[model samples]
Target: MSDFIAEQDRVLLERHGLASYEALWALTLEAVDEPNTERGGWSSVYRLDLGEQAFYLKRQSNHLTRNVLRPFGEPTFAREFRNIQRFKRLGIPSLEAAFFAKRRINTERQAVLVTRALDGWSDLQGLLESWPRLPGVERGEIVTACGKLMRNLHAAGQLHGCFYPKHVFLQRSSGGYAARLIDLEKTRPLLLGERDRLKDLDPFLRRTCAWSDDEVRHFLTAYLPIGTDIERWRLRLDARRRSKEFAVGAC
Candidate 1:
């Protein structure tokens, strides 16, 4: 029995043909509507539906280096599971993990993770693709909100290693817009360093190529006040733009 499988979910997993830890490797998965990048390659992810409930299954194959360190380091699936709980305890919106399992396959390691789906949410990147059309004030509000959320995460001593648009989800509810972070495999506690914290800004800046200078200015101001090394961040962002590493597409 996999200890990570929640007791309430065990019967559901069995009903879906995942009766054992090893079964996860052979379980047939239905792909959800997501970018091709999320499909099977180095890893496989699926959207599982059991009656009215929805969940996500993510299985990853570890590299040789990671396999070698299995004894000393926690598996990716375990780390993500812990991080999800940490985010929730810190009052940061995120999904809940229902199951996690890890096993060695010869020299390589394989792992599986299961989480409840974040329904009624859309990625921030998709929203920003229509940047040219959104009202200025609304756009500013989203930018400001995202900046504040990121600041809070950093202040909590956690680093979202992949701080990209696709990992950030936003939903409009009766109260207002709420933002949540996902894909937490790389999340970890922050050590003592400014560079690590600064790295979080890169992905946001890269996704803003479609934004006007005024929008970027507003975002930075809301993120960190003026006279707080704003120019330094701008220079670093511009350098990435010049390099054309992550091309920002237009709508």
Candidate 2:
């Protein structure tokens, strides 16, 4: 069994008897989402509230992903935990893992990951729903922040495999809006150059229907270098969008 508890959260988790793999795996809490039972394995997320603080606890059993590095299989949460630490080291804003543990019992593998809740942050989807009511400056601030976050992520040679609006979170900060990413289970190193950027950005553009052409241009302005051909990039994205639409329609 291997486990890690962030020093700041050690006392609280210890107090709740959740400092070990067995304790966290056996914990019962309100589930936040439906269990994902895929690849003959299962995973679920739960909301754990302790006093005024809140945390998210994720549990999985035999949920494995086979890769070149680990041809056999490894717990998905293990990858996620490593990515969380990597993001922190790279100065990327992301979830703060409070505790992470994994263990093997016979042929079964189980893992748990806990992260502190972003108390004041709101998902980009929720913020977009109220975009009309927000001040123009605030909207621009958020768009710029989002663009910068993406630029930073890509520049660091990391790709957020799933870059949907819901996975991007924002909070009002002293400078402006601060952006953070979550649901990094699919995150991997960026390869194939610009193709990797398109892979991540396409889905985000498709899902965020609230953005107008002007808003998109503004975002790209913030994302790209001063002399880069933004229109060409937009064309490529549009072509990809159409291909996606056609694929879905054909299905």
Best by TM-score: 2
For residues 59-149, write the lDDT of model 1, one tens digit per residue: 7765222335365544556677778879978877777777887887785667778888877788888888787898876676677767777
* Tens-digit lDDT string for candidate 2 (209-240): 68778888988898887899999999999888
Lowest lDDT block of 10, candidate 1: 33-42
- Runs in model 1 deviating more than 4 A are 5-26, 32-42, 61-75, 104-108, 225-251
- lDDT top scorer: 2
Q: What is the TM-score of each candidate against the true structure?
A: 0.74, 0.93
Those runs of model 2 whose alpha carbons end farther than 4 Å from true positions after fitting are 246-251
Clashing residue pairs, candidate 2? Answer: none
